[model samples]
Target: MSPPSGATTTFLLIEHRREIADLNERIRNRRLQVLSLYGTPIVVVLTLLVWAGLKIFIWLSSDTPTAINAIFFSVAVLLAVAAGAQFYAEFTATVWKDAETPVRELRLELSLADERHILEARRHTPPPTDRQASYKERLPQELVRLRIESRHYRRMHLMMQWLLFVSSAAISAVTAWYDPPQPAKGVLIGLGFTITVITAAAGYFKPRERAFNLQQTADSIEQHATALELGISPYNASEEKQNLELFATTVEGMRAEQRMREQQLDQPQQGQQQVI
Candidate 1:
C-alpha cells in the first residue's frame, strides 16, 4: 500500500502536535495551581491569620471565660480549611487526569502513523510558506514564546514589589499606633509576617532579574531576525540561505544563553549546598 501525500501527513503531524502541547500545558498549570494552594508559606500565612482573627475576636467580645472555647474554635476552623484545601487539590488532580487522557490518545494516534512513512513524506514536502522557516523553523515561534514569558515575569515582579511596599507601610502604620493588649497588635503581627514572606520570596525568586534576562534575549533574537530580513550588517550575505543559517545559529545561541541564565537563577545556591 502507498503512503499518504506529504501535505496530508504534515498537516496531521502539526495539528496533533499542537493539540498535545496544549493539553500538556493545561495539565501542568492545574498541578501548579494545586501545589500553590497548599504551599508551606501559604499555609503558614493562613494559619497566622486565623489565629490572629480568633484572638482579636475573643479580646473584643471581652469573653475571657470562653478563651478556651475560642482556642478550640480556631482549631476547628483550621481543620475545616485543611479539608477544603484537600478537596480542591483532589479536584485539580482530577482535572489534570482528564486533560492527560486526551494527550495520551493523541500520542497513540500519532504512533499509528509509520515513522518511515512520515519521514519520507516530510522529505518530499516543499518548504513551508514562511521564507524564514527554511531552517530552525521554530526560532520565530520561540522568540514570540520568550516575549510572552518575559511579560509574565515582568507582571509578577511588579505585583510582588507593590505587595512588599504596601505590606511594609501597613506594618509601620500599625506599629506607630500600637497599644498593648489590643486587637490592632494582632493585625500588626499578621502584617509583619506577610511582609517577611514577601521579602523572602522577592529575594529568592528575583522575578525582576528573570524578566530582564528574558526580555534581553528576546530583543537580541528579534534584532538578528530583523537584520536578516533587511540584509543588514553581518546578515548581509550574498546567498539568502547563508543569511537564514546565520540567523538560526545566532537565535539558537541566544536561546541557549537564556536557558543557562534561568538555571543559574533557579539554583543560585546549588554550589553552596554541594560544598556544605
Candidate 2:
C-alpha cells in the first residue's frame, strides 16, 4: 500500500514529539519542586521538635530566669507556627494538576490519531543512526527519571550539609555564651547530638557522592551516544551492529558500577546492625 504523504505525517510526528518533550520536562520540574517543598517542611519541623524538646527539658531542670525561659519558649512556638504555615502553603500548591493537564491532553491526542497515521508517523521518524541513538531509544524514560532523581539527591545532600555546619556552629556559640547550669546548655547538648547524628547519616548515605556518580554515569552514556550518532572518532566504524553491541556493553558496565557504589554505601549500616 502507498504510504501517507510525507508533509502531513512528518509534521504530526514532529509536533507530537515536541509536545511530549515539553510536557515531560514540565512534569519533571514540578515533581522536583514538590520534593523541595516537602523537604523544607521536614527539616523545619525536625528542628522545631528538637528546639522545643530541649527548651522544655532545660526549663524543668535548670534555675534559669522565668522571663528568659518564657521568651525562648515563645520563640520556639512561633517557629512551629511558621513551619506549619509553610507546610500548609506547599500542600495547597497546584503544580501537579497544572503539569498533569497537558500530559493528559497529549495522551488523548495520540490515542485519537488514526492507526495508519500512527504507523506513518513512526515510519517517518528517524531511526537510531549510532550507538548513542540506540541507547537513547532503548532507555529514554529511564535516563530522564535517573537525571531527575540525581538532581533531587544533590539538593537534599546540600541542605543536609548546611544544616550540619549551622548546628555545629550554634553548639559552639551556645557553649561559649553561658555557664554550665543554664537551661540553654541542655538546648546546646540536644542540638549537638542531633548534629552528630546528621553528620553520621550524611557520611553513611553519601547522597552528594551518589548523586555525582549517577550524574557522571548518565553523562558518560550520553557522550557515547552522541559520538555514535555523529559517527565521530572511536565510533566511526562501518559495521553499525558491532558499534551498538560495544555501546550497550559499556552502558551496562557503567550501571554495574553504580550498583557497586550503592552497595558500598549500605555497608556501614549493615555492619552496625550485625554488631547489635
Candidate 3:
C-alpha cells in the first residue's frame, strides 16, 4: 500500500477528530441553551396555571390569607423574571446565530476533510478478509443505543405509573375519612386531575410497550452476537463469511421489526387525527 500524501495524512490526524468532536459538543450546548430559553417561560406559565387554579379556589371560599397573597406575589415576580429572560434571549438571537455560524462553517469544512481523509485512508489500507469486522464494530454501539432508549422509556413509564397510583391512593385515603377542609379538598382536586392526566399520557404514549420492544430487540441482537461468536446453531455456518452474513441479517431484521412495532403503536394516534 502506498503512503498517503502529506495533505491527506494531515487531514487524517487526531487533531481534526478532536476539533470536530469539540465543535459538536459546543453546538449541542448552544442548542440546549436555546431550548432552555424557550422552555423556561413555558414551564413558568404552567406553574402559574396551577397556582392560579389554587388561588381561584381560595378566592371562591372568600379566605384571602396573607401567606397566599405573599406566595402569589412571589410567583408574579418569578414570572416577570422568566419573561425578561425570554425577551433577552429573543433579542440576542442574532448574537447566538453569529457565534454559531463560524462553528458550523468550520465543522462543515472539517467534515469534508474527514470524508476525504477516510477515502484516502481506505485507499491505503488493505480490505479486511472478514466483512463482519465493520458490522461487529458497529453492533455493540447499536446495542448500547437500544438499551439506553429502552431504559429511558422504562423510567418514564414507571415514574408516571407511580404518580398515578400514589395520587389515587392518597385521594382514596382522604375521601374515605372525615370530610376534608377547603384547602385539603382543593389539593385533592389537583391530585385527581394529575391522576387523570398521567393515566391518559400512559395510555397514549405506551411507554411500557415501547420499552419492552426496544429491550427485547436489543436482547435478541445481543444473543445473536454471542451465538455468532460461539458458532452456535443458525449461526453455525462452516464459512465465517456466511455466519457473519446470517448474524447481520438476523440483527437487521429484528431492528426492522422493532421499527414496525413503533409505527404500529403510532398508528392509533394517526388514525384518530385522520378521522378528526
Candidates' lDDT values, in order?
Answer: 0.70, 0.70, 0.77
RMSD of 3: 7.5
Model number with the top TM-score: 3
- Candidate 2 segments whose C-alpha is farther than 4 A from its true place: 1-135, 269-276
Please, what's the RMSD in Å of model 2?
10.6
Q: Write down the TM-score of every candidate.
A: 0.60, 0.49, 0.63
Positional deviation of residue 67's Cα in model 3 after best superposition, in angstroms:
14
Q: Per-residue lDDT tens digits of candidate 3, residues 61-129?
A: 776678877886787788779767656655655545424344466567668767865776666563443
User: Tens digits of per-residue lDDT for model 1 on 112-215?
Assistant: 44454466556666653334565545567877888898899899889988988998898778767765537687787787788888788887888888889988
Model 2: how far residue 274 lies from native, Å: 16
Question: TM-score of predicted model 3?
Answer: 0.63
Between prediction 1 and prediction 2, the one with superior TM-score is 1
What global local distance difference test value does model 3 have?
Answer: 0.77
Candidate 2 local lDDT, residue 235: 76
Question: Which candidate number maximizes lDDT?
Answer: 3
- So what's the TM-score on candidate 1? 0.60
